[model samples]
Target: MSYILEILPSLLEGAQLTLKIFLWTVVGSIPLGLIVGLGLTSHFVPLKAILKFYVWLMRGTPLLLQLIFVFYGLPLIGSGALTLQRYDAALFAFILNYTAYFAEIFRGGLQSIDHGQYESAKVLRLSYLQTVRKVITPQVLKIVLPSIGNEVINLVKDSSLVYVIGLGDLLRAGNVATSRDVTLVPLILVGVIYLLMTAVLTFILRKLEQHYSYWK
Candidate 1:
């Protein structure tokens, strides 16, 4: 117990960074994804083509590779215009990668709405923005919430990938402690912490789903 207590602070610090990354990624990705999702459904050919290609590239590649590219690959080019700090790189990769996924989910949600709803909104003289906000968004939210919850949970685990960029995330902290003390205790604690985070998030997401279930 003494040894565990001694190592707890470092592990907690790492967990804090992990949480930061996860939260920021969720915040940054969702709105951007909504925009991308709208673009995917737009009738404009060029815009749709670009967004589709962007989504494909992001979803097709491993997020680890994206992290490497953002952190390591970009700096190799002669100009420093694209350089990012370790933490920034990790957040950028995570948000961008997850945005692609969320975009697809949102696109599907948006597409699933009945076409007559749009016509009804038009007959009501509702602007496109008003219609989307007042009528379409609630239904889309209920449709996408489950999918978003899955991604958010995945984000918790994926935050560990920041260690590859030398960000000292939860997994790295545990690894450091284990290597230094030659005990698995810190690693076990790290796993427990991750499980706890996911469990809490699960509870919150369930509540959100229940609240939105009225749309059904």
Candidate 2:
């Protein structure tokens, strides 16, 4: 236990960076995804085609490759126009990757809504914006919440991928401790930390699901 106490602060420090990446990705990706998903549903064929292509590229590629590209590839082609700090590069890549996924999820949720819902909103003379805001979005949120929660938990684990860029994170911290002490305890602790985080997220999401159970 004393050994755990000794390494706890360092692990938490790394966890903080991991948490930062997860949160920023969630914050940035959700809205960007919504916009892209709306574009996917737009009547404009060209716009939908372009957004679809973007989503395909984001979703088709590996996120680790995307991170490497953001950090290393863009600079090669950027001609001094696209330099990003390490944190910025990671943030940009994570947002780009997650946005594609969320866009598809949101698109699915949007498609699930019966056309009658829109017709009903139209009968009430709601504007397009009003219909989305007051009717469609609320329903979509409930439908997509579980998927979004899953992605959020994934983000927490995926944050460790930043280690590929040599950015310190919980797993990397464990690696450092293990290398130094030649013990497996720190690695086990890291796994526990991951489990604890996912458990908390699961509990919170379950509560959210219950709150939305009114639909049933």
Candidate 3:
């Protein structure tokens, strides 16, 4: 117990890193995901094909492999233009992986919308962008908020993968503390921290669902 107390500050520091990664990953990925989702639904055959291929490649492969490739391979292939520090590499990897997954979720949400919505928006004389922004997106968000919430919760846990690239996130912090003291208590503490984070995320997402429910 005393050991746990002693390590509390270090664990909190690690939690900060974990939170930072989670926040940035969501910020960077959400817009990219929306764009990719739009591209996947594009009318242009070539554009659709390209976006489909991108989504497939990202989703089909393991994120760990993708992280290694981005961090290690890019430096080998395009060292000058794609130079990345460890933290940057982890951020890039998480963004790419999460963006692809979120894009699919967004695509699924968009597809769930009825075709009649588009026609109705057109009847209202809204441009394509306006139609999407004002009409389709709101409905889609209502339909997919639950799923997006799950993904967001999962992302909080997944941020631990940043440790693979040497980003000192929560799991890595616990590992470091455990190694020094030769005990597993720190790991348990780390798990509790992660659970707490996920709980908070779930609560926020639930609130978001309720907030958006008015649109339905």
Best by lDDT: 1
Model 3 lDDT-worst window of ten: 207-216
Displacement of residue 171 (Cα, Å) in model 2 is: 0.8
Task: Show model 3 residue runs off by greater than 4 Å.
Answer: none
**Candidate 3 residue pairs in clash (backbone atoms < 3 Å):** none
Which pairs clash (backbone N, Cα, C closer than 3 Å) in model 2?
A: none
Clashes of 1: 0
Candidates 1 and 3, the one with greater TM-score: 1
Which residue segments of model 2 deviate by more than 4 Å?
A: none
Q: lDDT scores for all predictions?
A: 0.94, 0.91, 0.86
Worst 10 contiguous positions by lDDT, candidate 2 = 33-42
Model 2, TM vs. native = 0.96
lDDT value, candidate 2, whole model: 0.91
Per-residue alpha-carbon lDDT of model 2 for 4-52, expressed as tens digits?
A: 9999999999988988898899999998887788788888999999999
